[model samples]
Target: MSYQALYRVWRPQRFMDLVGQEMVTKTLKNAIITHQTSHAYLFTGPRGTGKTSAAKIFAKAINCRFSKEGEPCNECETCKAITEGRLNDVIEIDAASNNGVEEIRDIRDKVKYAPTEADYKVYIIDEVHMLSTGAFNALLKTLEEPPANVVFILATTEPHKIPATIISRTQRFDFKRITAESILQRMIYILDQKNVDYDDKALKVIAKAAEGGMRDALSLLDQVISFGDNNVTLDNALLVTGSVTQESLFNYLKFVLSKDTTNALKEIQQIVEQGKDANRLIEDLINYCRDLLLYQQAPEMVSDGELGLLDDKFKELSQQINVTQLYQIIDELNKQQENMRFSSHQSIYLEVLTVKLTQLSTNSEADRVSNVDLSQIELLKQKIENLQRKVDNLSSNTVQTEKNNEPRKQVRKNTTKGQKNVKINLSQVYSVLNNATRQSLNELKQVWPDLMNMLSVTQRAIMHVSEPVAASENGVVVGFEYAFLCQKALEDQELIDTLENGLDRLIGKVPSLVLIPVENWPEIRSNYLKQRKNGAVVIADDTSEQSQDNDDQSASTQPTIIQKAEELFGTDIVEIKND
Candidate 1:
């Protein structure tokens, strides 16, 4: 016997050995047992599933000369010949090459005759959907009402292409795609029977390489066995198909997840240089990203569904990132894949995409540094700072206000006209209180610079009232002139004591400080005269004037104390109503 490949050798000689189509197998067995077999049967599914194989088995069961129960008795000479494809009564036709009406007419003429040897004559047509409409019409009449011992079996990967009228005459069976686990178990049994020394990982590679096609899995195992030299390791299987090792893809994904684009891009380049199929990489990447997104969303529970080939590291990678971020990454990569289809510079596009993804992943990091707000916020804040400076200037004590439109300089100039022989002797007075210095004088400058300017021109002894004592124990009296009300308010002893102990103390010789009311100034002497004479003063008007000092500065001092206070303080003082 010539050498047969494992799939052809172990080609499911009996219905019991077929791997993942138990439902179809059971139904066929029951039909045969119940003797309810139809005249025409249609089997449809994807390639590598047992659609064609099932048709063969049905042919064998119906034709077996010594069949027992529902199954063909393989011990008999008739059953063995049928299984070995030597039966003259059964016909197997390939519709792909014989799709013409003449070929189908030959089949139509042959079905008219009775069975040669077997009880029933079975015509098995593979890829029957490939037949033209004329061919289907030629066979339709015989298919609907076939001879008593004649049966027609049509198998196709796509049943939808067949006309409904032709389909309606036949009983249809849909074969399901086999699962990876089911394919794996079958591959294991084959390897054990062949005495093949193979790793489980190699078996997994063959199973996943099948992608639900049992024939594809067998073909992969055959190819790997030829190159694998009796040691079917993962590396051998990977090399046979120019396929990437799952570990390489997983490692690159790990580097990508770490935001280490440098290594990830390098690894992907290595993969491309190895001549691995780029489409497979994309498909695996999409699956990887989907699993990661699912695991990220719900750590406690994740169903493996169709992606059972993914290993434990894939699950770990899935749980490594947030679901939302993973989805964004996958969507971006998918868009890149679509764009790559039209671009001639696919390598450059992939490299640029990798760099951009690295930059994006940096941005996606939970600990990403916030960017500095360089323009609008800082510029508006600067403008606010300037406005704040203006507000601060209004509260400063130096900028004094005038009641009317007259400038304060003009008022000070007019008030400077005083009697030369007044004999105030301010220095001699300040000597009585021990509160007189430039330190105190600067504060006087802060509030009473105009008055101090006037007093300095006279060269009299005047002192700023920083802390002038008034009790007799100090042998001094503290007083202030009408021009220096603001200067007198600095009589804070705690501040004065701190000043006296400093390097530049404001305290000087003791002085008897007296604060004179504005009326006592030489500018308003008539008001003083009325008060001392048990009399009152009259207000001056243009029509009537009781007393007028046309050239005198002391004519207006006769106002009451409350009137003077109101005039001096103006709006700065609040007057309470007694009502």
Candidate 2:
């Protein structure tokens, strides 16, 4: 006589009413029809997957006097009483609340009784995993061998918590999660039966949000229906589901693709102000990009139900962003999502994420530029001309300096008040450049960006403004654009480790890292070249006691190749054998 929830009103009463579990339903139905029903059964799956509903249907079907083809006839008093939960022969228990030994003992004591009004007595226990050890032990023997005309059905979302002995006693049926398509169809059928006007997109949104749970889908549909005044509209559905509209997501992503950070942040602020959760928004964006990528690879695989509408705008956006760019954006977003999990200042992280995404998009666009483009060719020509002018100016300056016999001003680190200064070991730099070959430097440069991509967002941002300028067999000299970033890179040991590990994978050896400001890089390279031109071999001077001791130790002990391999690859990767 009162208004009931949609899930409650439309609860599956028969095996045929259960959606997205044809195999489970068919197996249960065949068992009942063939009169070969097991005395005990264990049903396991995610919630809203129709485990309990199937159990009830099975109970009613086996006891219904007028049952046909293993289906319960609702007209019979037995099926009607069971469906209404008034049948004395059918019992349903919540193990979560009554998960003690005493409660199980009570059930164990009652299994000897015969059915009062039906041919068989059925017991359905939901959330059976919550039963304590003693309670499980108490029920194990009874479940293995029940009285005649008695059946027990145990259902749980987590089957792993059930002991192996308890699990071995019953016939286990694993229910699968319902698909979004199946949920959408079920919602449409319900809405049509109720004659409620609903947008197809609205149903799709609810279905995707349900994540394969029919009860959740119906619950969300109920909320949307109530919010929409019984009219399931797209806006109402999005509001109820706390989902970003496809249009809004498309617009935000468009700004990101265009590298428009200002507009993108503006869009994000609006979305957050509207009360959308940060983690949820990030998850939706990831899914949206995943759908876009799927569409890019195979348009037919992505349907309207999965990706809202998939209109002309969606197609156009997919065309604009290449697969590689999508991959970069997704990876960056996933990293940011993980970072935001424990973060209190989520909005700040989101702002930072927006900037990173736009930067990635810009980098990807630059990478896609054609090598034969006239603009790039012009840019290269200008750079070459500038280098030539610089060379000529240097030549003139050198002649003047020689005439005056003046020493060139020493290129030193420029430190200002409150400015952090990164200490670059000049001796180390000299050594790397001393042994640096063109081949090593080129190889480092080739894999630098790829290595940077493997780092976390903060590390990547700091390292992106740097380049591998010179490298040797044992070390690399990276030049950062700013002194602060250079200092940050020097202090971040994790970043250093990640870079070294990534490099080891990319190229076969792990080289130590040396960082310096880009402002001083040209001078450093120029000074090193000048010293080499003058036939001055630059080498690291051993000044520290540790260095002297290390040299002494090396002189005394000759390390075998196995020791070197162990040092390079770690002891775990190297094995030694007796000769």
Alpha carbon lDDT of each predicted model: 0.64, 0.83
**Residue 270 of model 2: what lDDT?**
96
TM-score, every prediction? 0.59, 0.62
Model 2: per-residue Cα lDDT over 183-283, one tens digit each: 99999999999999999888988999999899999999999988889899988988889999888899999999888999999999999998888888998
Clashes of each: 25, 0
Best by TM-score: 2
The reply for model 1, stretches above 4 Å from the true place, is 294-312, 332-353, 359-579
lDDT of 2 at 197: 97
lDDT of 1 at 172: 89
